[model samples]
Each structure stands twice: as structure tokens, then as C-alpha cells.
Target: MVSSDDTYLSMRGGVSRGIRRMGGEEIYKESQDCRILNALSIGDVVVTSAGNLPANKIFHGTVIDWQLELFPSKKIIQKVVHDCLIKANHYGYKTIVFPLLGTGAGCLNKQIAWEIMLKQIIMDLSTIHQTLIEVVITLYGRETLSDLNWKFFINEMQAKWEIK
Candidate 1:
């Protein structure tokens, strides 16, 4: 799973800690150094290797800066999601997984975050012609984001996409 962050050096909190566990300390360090040259602001993304994980790459998106805002704006989240998908397509990655961004330490409303994410994903997918890219939306760890109501989200997405 990819961790979301601001343009800061410290990699604390849930997702960042997960990255550290997955041997992504090097990637995090590199990202920090890269950020000095190219700082990651809201709606910006930074792609990195998944380290020892099964995924081919990790797309670190800067959705919110806790220091600046209490929660991320829906527009910013949508843009970040779009950017991540574009980056994934550019890298020829057919499959990608995303956590419920802006919900953990960013303290965004779970329902609102899910709605924005699903809407942006559906919109982005509709623009693609015949590409078979698989986008996976995961909770990362259920314990960490217990407030996220997945059942409601799945039902909403199914209704939106008319999925059987």
C-alpha cells in the first residue's frame, strides 16, 4: 500500500509506519530528498517502488497537510486520485491498490472521502477506451480505519456503476 503525506520529512502515522515495515525506509528517504527539490503539495503525487511488497510500484500522493488544513478538500483529493491513475497508466501498471486516503491521520470524513474517491475513479475509468486496468480500493488495515463504512461504499459504487 502507498502512504499519503505532506511535503515534510517525518514519516509518522499509520500508512507511513506500514511503509517502514515493508522496507520502504529507503524509498521514504529518497522521497524526502526528492521533496526538497520538488516538494509534494496537495494534489501532487510521487511514485516509488513498493520495496518488498507484492505490488510493482507505490504511488505516494499528497492529499492533505495536517499543518495547513484539518482535512483535505474534495477537489484536491480528486486531483490526486486522477494524477495517481495517470502515473500508473504511464508506468504500464495494469493493477494498483489504494488505501482510503485522507481518512487516517488526515482526519477527513470517511463517507466524504470514499464518495470522492469512487467518483473520481469511475470518471477516470470512463475516459479510458479499452484498457484493462484493475483498480483496487483497499482499507489497508481494518483496525486502522474502522470508521470507514465499506458496505455502504460498495453499495454506492455498485449503484453508481450499475455493477451486477
Candidate 2:
């Protein structure tokens, strides 16, 4: 929703933009209904129909409280990661793709966010299969991988976690 008024939404998020690029526009609308949006709160994780996305269910986790602070904290990041992992494991999901939460929408500092999110994920998942799960850390951007230290991130992921 865009606003001609001063307070109207000015832009769509990266995730929504990517989804739209993938031909999930209708599903995007379905996922953005008042109920789903309203039910989600900071630190809360909720599951909704995947709609047109490839997955069957999408777990929406709230790590940033736009009302509370300028950036998200380690605890908030950890909480959402832990909760989402538990929920995904409960559903017996073998694969979960986690976008580096709080790193977007003018939120957390990227380096610190990466550390906290990765540590929590590795520590928690270790108790599960190592876990036998494929974790995808999505960093969506308009630039190419050469623009960022993609190799460093990949090395960190491999060195820190025994990803399946």
C-alpha cells in the first residue's frame, strides 16, 4: 500500500519484492491480510500458508520491534531463531531457509546480526541432526555477490556449522 498521505507505506520490503519477482503476487496479498499481520508481534513467530511460494508453510518470525528500538538485540534475534527452529522441528520440516533476520529494513548491524543469528542457529541445531537440515541464509540485494564478502560468509557458515 502506497500513500499519497504523509504516513503511507513508501516501499515494499526485499522479501516481498523477491516474492513478486517469483510470480507470487497473489500469494503475497494473501499473506499480508490484517489477521496475519495483526497476530504477529515482536519476538513472536507464526506460521501461515505458503500460498504461491515453493514451500508448504512459511514461518514468519518477528525479531525487530519497529516501535521499541532502532535496532534489534541479540536476545530478540536468539528468541526468534530458537522459536522458529522449535516450530519447524515440530512440523518435522527437514529443510528451513532463514533469511538473515534483522539485517534488513534499516534494522540490525549486519555483522553483529550475522554472529548472533548464526551462533544461535548452530548451537540449537547441533542438538537436532547436527541437524540434518539444510539452512539457507538469504541476503537479498540488487548488487552482485562480488559487491559483498559472499565467500567470507560461506566460509563462516561451513567452519561454524556442519550443514547438511
Candidate 3:
């Protein structure tokens, strides 16, 4: 899954840019897909076929809209992440990968973004006892974000789920 701006334009930067750079032609063309008729609002999620990528699907969440006047909200981030998980379950998917929602083009602080994303993941997973859903959060940065020990933080959260 990737965080996309509300407009879903051919964003030449951020997550979209990386995918494009890696030859995600089908994913790129979803911008013109009729199902995406209008600009998405914050927290909205749209699923599309992964172009040439190996994944079965791509979940594009509207976690930010840098062009808009509205500031990114923690609530919006939580909503998008949770919604994407639900959507994945709807498709009978056992696993879904997500990127830090607001850290890239959203211009959000990396630490805050990670905290918000991890918290939302934990909360959602807590309520999902019906089935085992594996979730992965990946960070792709040009420069090291040494401030947060992400591996340690994620493992700490994993331990809380140890007995559940």
C-alpha cells in the first residue's frame, strides 16, 4: 500500500515517484481509472490492480493533500490505515504492506508519523481476532532517520501482542 495525495496525480515525488521509477505502469495508469472519478478526501482509500508489480493489489490512501489548506490530521492517518486493513480483509488478502503515511510528500515529521502509524496498526490488529492478518510497515528513505529505533519500537509493540 502507498500513501497518495488526494488528487492522485502522477506524483513525480514521494511514494508514487518511487513506484513509477520502479516501472509500475499499471499502478500509474490508475490515476485515469474511471472508478477514481473524483479527488479523494483525507482518510479515503482506493484499491487498484498493481500494474506490473508483483503485488496482487495496490491500496492508495488519501493520507494527505499538500495542495489543500487543511493540515494533516492524526485522525485522518488512523482512519486511512484502519480502512485499508478492512479493505484488504474484504478481498481475502492475508497480508498487506504499508508505508509510513505522512512522512513523505505530506512533509510530516518522521517520528510523529511512525508513532501514529504504529499506534493505529496496533489498535486495529487488536480488534481483528477472527483471522490472522499479517501487516508490514516499510520505510524507504534516502537519508537515515537515526532518531527513532524503528525496529526496536516495532518489536516492542509485537511483544504486547505476544500473549494474545
Per-residue CA lDDT of model 3 for 83-153, tens digit only, reads 88888877887788887776776777777777888888788777775243688777776545476677777
Please provide, for model 2 over 90-142, each residue's C-alpha lDDT reduced to its tens digit, 9 standing for 90 to 100.
Answer: 87777777766766664666666667777787788877544336666666565
Candidate 3 has an lDDT of 0.71
Between the candidate structures 1 and 2, which one is better when assessed by lDDT? 1
Worst 10 residues of 3 by lDDT: 2-11
Name the 10 consecutive residues with the lowest summed lDDT in model 2.
Answer: 1-10
Candidate 2 has what TM-score? 0.67
List the candidate numbers ranked by lDDT, top first: 1, 3, 2
Model 1 whole-model lDDT (C-alpha atoms): 0.73
9-69: candidate 1 lDDT, tens digit per residue: 3567677667767755777776776678885667678776777777777677787665677
- For residue 124, model 2's alpha carbon misses the true position, in angstroms, by 0.6
Candidate 1 positional error at 159, Å? 6.6
Give the true-structure RMSD of model 3: 3.3
